[model samples]
Target: MKSRMHKGVSLILGLGTACTIGLSSLEPASALPWQQLIFNGVQLLQLSNISPQQTVALGQNIHQQVKQNYRLDSNSKTNAYVNRVGQRLAKASNCSQIPFRFYVVRDSSINAFATTGGYVYVHTGLLNAVDNEDQLASVIGHEIAHICNNDLINKLKQTQLAQGAASLAGLDQSAVTAIAYQLAVDLPNSREAEFNADDKGLQYMRRAGYNPKAMPAFLRKLVRQSSAPSFLSSHPATQERISVIERKIANGR
Candidate 1:
């Protein structure tokens, strides 16, 4: 599926356009314009018309949901370590203006995800799985790219649009809610979005003084461990993404 695009301050098609109507009409007390309002309401608009403030709010909401669902590390040192690395990577990202916060979920699943609100969650399994700081930075950079690109917001906006359509067609709130929740959790981003994020992520790692080559190494590990049913395994490694990264590295050299 093609990712939706935001048409500056005007209403565009798909999720961005729908969010312009949904969020703006719902919160009349806010002074945000339709363009700003739509940007704030959806993750996809963050890269284009969405303002930083809206992105922060969306991140906060997603963080809260994540905290509620997963167990956060209680060890202050672990939290601090994750935050320090995350901060370094965030500063190197293209969207440096977005305040990126990182946390380690107290789960054994080897998975990490980025929220539209500039929040990144890394599972303990992933932390333990990586060999060095560069590999870890590669993972962080990838997730940061997802957030900077507003992939999550776009996914959420699409969910909201589908739910609204379902409601209009006589679907009950429960049904709409179920579908929306699934989409939000699954993040069905297109292959193009994945590839774009990988390319941008490598840039982030390189800018942060990390060994950009670690990305391919980490991906190789993921490919070898594909049979393992881990949280990180949720996103199966693909040869296409690795090939793109190799080309990027060659071009950079």
Candidate 2:
């Protein structure tokens, strides 16, 4: 019994480290061959209470590293546009108490990603992909949902617990931060996380007065391509995602 319990705990603890390092699934369950469960079960370990201040400080660390690798979009107009859209969605998010910040990357890839401390990055390519503001809001809303859902904090806590609680040993602060940086800039979240983001993002879209269907519409356009777009490289988006999201829209949840 003791050995069995320890094995279960270890698996859950490992998810935090795996999520942080940007190391995750490649086995798709259904329509998407790329999707897989990072953990053995659906349960995410929320073992610790990470205060907003701790997350903000860690987020700053992660963001500093992000700026070093990617060039920020220099266009004042583009900067304002993405931030403007992101800010509006933040108000409708579950974690509205803290400020949300958005940045635009100069790269022309259809990608957007978020990190702790309410920071989200949008690619110029993604901006060009959407037909209107509502589409952009839905994307940003999804990112906001990631941050607001305590997904970031959960990763950090998992990393800590996997190492040890009392000694403050293991990966050390800098190593963990480095892993988290990669997670923000270049990784696919677990399938469960992706689904939650889809669900909550729609709610935020409706609350913020953006067309709720815009998310599914935008997504359907992507899947129609002869090949998956660059956006799917970082996200686990699949046909299953679209079907589930559409159902949510119908139910108005």
Candidate 3:
């Protein structure tokens, strides 16, 4: 399993608890035997060529269904505030060219997830976890980076391909939408994807004039917790992640 871990990538959002307990270093999560057989990790992926218009359309469909199912924060102020912060980083994004929209989920879990076409959801628990705007930006920027880099899109592509759907060429629209939500809540991504998100998120923070140190600073807080955070824990290197981000900040990246 160790040798076959880098099969397919899953940008699973809010994947419950991480398997590591008191783990000190980062290591890629070993793919399940089944995953190893069918999936290809993000590092080795050639993403689906679903058109930009199709992606946005699919995203809108997914977004609408998600809003209906998730207990979203109804406070206009909170939603507007998150949207403002998100748009700033969205502008700083390098690869994602879509109009990003941010929403607040009325949950008390320290989690956040992104899906296709520039939709980002932040948990109220995650909101309260951040000590300041910079930290919040750190979280938001990370999610934005996932969208910018098309992690979600690639995950969907991998799933479709693994199941022999290949592309969105003729699949049922609702099924594709369901997979997006399923991946967000159920899968874990590659360590490479997390590193990419951290790197790009940090860059977005800097470009948006937010303190980039907040990336590691916030992750450190999570690690100090009695239990590891799923967001940082999905990949084993919470400590290593902090070090990498700190190095980036130190080098003015």
lDDT of all predictions, in order shown?
0.65, 0.71, 0.69
Per-residue C-alpha lDDT of model 2 across residues 105-203, encoded as one tens digit per residue: 887778888899888999888999899999999899998999988676656554654444332323334445566675555545667788889999999
Q: Which residue segments of model 2 deviate by more than 4 Å? A: 1-47, 163-172
Point out the worst 10-residue segment of candidate 1 by lDDT: 1-10
After superposition, the stretches of candidate 3 with alpha carbons farther than 4 Å from their true spots are 1-47, 166-171
| Candidate No. with top lDDT | 2
Could you list the CA RMSD of all candidates, in the order they appear?
8.5, 11.3, 10.0
TM-score of each: 0.73, 0.78, 0.76
Clashes per candidate (backbone, < 3 Å):
5, 1, 9
Q: Write the per-residue lDDT of candidate 1 for residues 140-173, one digit (tens) a residue.
A: 8888998888776565454445444323333332
The candidate 3 region of ten consecutive residues with least summed lDDT is 1-10
- In model 3, residue pairs whose N, Cα or C atoms come closer than 3 Å (at least 3 residues apart or on different chains), thus clashing, are 7-39, 7-40, 7-41, 8-39, 8-40, 8-41, 13-184, 26-236, 26-237
Worst 10 residues of 2 by lDDT: 29-38
The TM-score leader among the candidates is 2
